[model samples]
Target: MSSNPDNGPAVSRREFDELFEAVRTWGRWPAPGRGAWNRVTADHVRAAASLVRTGTVVPIGRPWDTRPGPDNTRPALHHMSDLGDVEPPEPSAYKDFLGADYHGKSVTHLDALSHLAYRGLLYDGRDARGSVGAGGARFGSVQELGPLVTRGVLLDLPAVLGVDWLEPGRAVHAADVTAAERALGVTLGDGDAVLLRSGRFRRRRELGPWDCGAASAGWHVDAVPLLGERGVCLLGADGDSDVRPSPVEGVHSPVHTLAITAMGVPLLDNLDLEALSAACAGAGRYAFLLVATPLNVPGGTGSPVNPVAVM
Candidate 1:
């Protein structure tokens, strides 16, 4: 996918038709509410027996696995506080000692609102220019995504690509997201969280901290408006969600990252794709998803997630 509208835009009538049809079949559809996050339980999925036409949804997000791995660069870990006196059993045990970096990685983590900011204020409207971006832009933490527990949908693009890596700088447009839903024969809801798989996390772990993406995997900024229109609150991907190319002349993050943050959404990055994607492909279904929030640790940019999706 390329933003070069010169190569032509990504949308197609056939893709849209399939998407529209899938939604039309989803019974008892509800309009998205203010927060737009609702957990999906097995019973609720079974209840949607009314909507099943054919096929299943594959788990399309990445799983976070840690070793004595590298950390993501986002301040907080600048000092590179030394490894603790005691050696932990598993990488996870060292999370807290990871200081702000955590296990040298923040894989499978939820993106906090504090990760980005517009000119001055954060989502909650406090002058971060006066304080830390980690504030709730309020009396406490600046992020509001801690409350996000929504119906998440996985779009397994790499499975369809028959390749491990989705080329870097390639665009995974709004239409491809929809095309995937059609391929799975599922309709997306207004509030659904979209977790994308570009197979970037399969990259070498030796890249050290802040290193992610396999050969190449990233999305385009052009998809933001449509995501906003769809009211998507979270965008989780195996790689960076927005179209920020490394070595850009002058920018911390890509424009879409800033634009989406301005819209008050969080971007979960560097997910593991092996087991999850395989399970979904084997199940031939995309129903049944769960994420526990009791896992959140405030004042951090991201956290590891072991989110499970059932068929």
Candidate 2:
């Protein structure tokens, strides 16, 4: 419950708590760390593989951001270590190194369950302060999620509305999600990966970069329960999935807290889904085989990833 103002989506603490109780998956899974990813089995992967009709592959990863701006506070580092000009080598080799604080607007990344905490507790009721520290997370680490292979449903909101992109700060409600599903000719189901595309990158390319942290079109807390009911294993978006000026007062990222802490679902953020949207539209289908393999960093909260969709 935010005490800031009643101007936006006002959610009392009681309501948020009740929602948390209703969706919490603590003690439900056989293993402790895998969370909702456990829903996607071998059968799901095999079924997902059947989606590759044209063998069209679309990459949803944003370009490595090396330029600093209001949105990219910590630009990714990339430099050539060897340029094939040294040591009198007949067969000269070229090498490069790259690095970044990837958990921001500039990078396409996956957020593990450890990334969000509510009321001092991480997903599965683990003590946040006790489990997560300088070394990294002891529970809900990205390594535990491994590779995700499932049917992906694209909710292209802008396309559904016949708009270039949704305006920043526009809150996407459950109704909007359902409408997009109907319009896109897709239905989300168990273990499916639902990607909401707001055309953030397209808008940025056209209008130039703005402060995404201050304003972005994303999910409202009200949308989480709908997704939970659909049993979607993974959620992603062009934005970080929380509507700016968060409908919930006091909570900076209520959707993050709700989806990760309450629903035990991982998230993919800052994706560039423009190409995928076009590919799906041209194919007359919005569903595809989505594959994402995160870096296996033990005790890590999340990982920078380049997710791919095959249609």
Residue-level error in angstroms, candidate 1, position 300: 4.5
Which candidate number would show the highest TM-score if scored against the true structure? Answer: 2
- lDDT tens string, model 2, 138-197? 999999899888999899999999999988888888899888889988888999999999
Q: Provide C-alpha RMSD values for all models, in order.
A: 9.2, 2.1
Question: By summed lDDT, which 10 consecutive residues of candidate 1 come out lowest?
Answer: 25-34
Error of 1 at 299 (Å): 4.6
| TM-score computed on alpha carbons, candidate 2 | 0.95
Q: Write model 1 residue lDDT over 75-135, tens digit each, in one string.
A: 2332333455556665532223333343223455555554554455544443555545444
Q: At residue 193, what lDDT does model 1 achieve?
A: 64
The C-alpha stretches of model 2 lying farther than 4 A from their native spots are 1-8
